[model samples]
Target: MDFSALNKSAANSFNQQKSLIKKVLAGKKVKCNNCNTLISVHTGADSVMIKCEKDCTDIKLDAELLK
Candidate 1:
């Protein structure tokens, strides 16, 4: 079975997610898929976090994405 295509697809998805995260970091509004509420992105000295007011979606991004 070919894995290159799968790898490429994964890479593309990752890039898209990173792009979205960057937009959030820049103060763009993003919504939570589960709760359909505004997502709040917070950046710290060493990490980035995203969450909704309802707490349905919470994710702590790797610090490397800050670049």
Candidate 2:
């Protein structure tokens, strides 16, 4: 995965939402609503809604990292 782009996007999206990011990062686990996959919420931003590159169905947003 091109984390550079993800990180960039997350940073931009969470520019003013530092608290959100912190909350997400504080947790060790996160889940993908579309794929039901568990992802780790580490750095960058919280619940950064990203499009699924594998199968672009409906817009999949990260639910773990939200306000």
TM-score of each: 0.55, 0.26
lDDT score for candidate 1 against the true structure: 0.76
- Which residue ranges in model 2 land beyond 4 Å of their true spot? 1-23, 41-67
Error of 1 at 30 (Å): 1.2
**Which stretches of model 1 miss by more than 4 angstroms?**
1-19
Can you write out model 2's per-residue Cα lDDT over 33-52, one digit (the tens) per residue? 45755544322354443322
Candidate 2 pairs with clashing backbones: 47-65
lDDT of 1 at 9: 82
- TM-score for candidate 2, residues paired by index: 0.26
Could you tell me how far off, in angstroms, the CA of residue 59 lies in candidate 2 after the best superposition?
13
Clashes of each: 0, 1
For candidate 1, what is the total of clashing residue pairs? 0
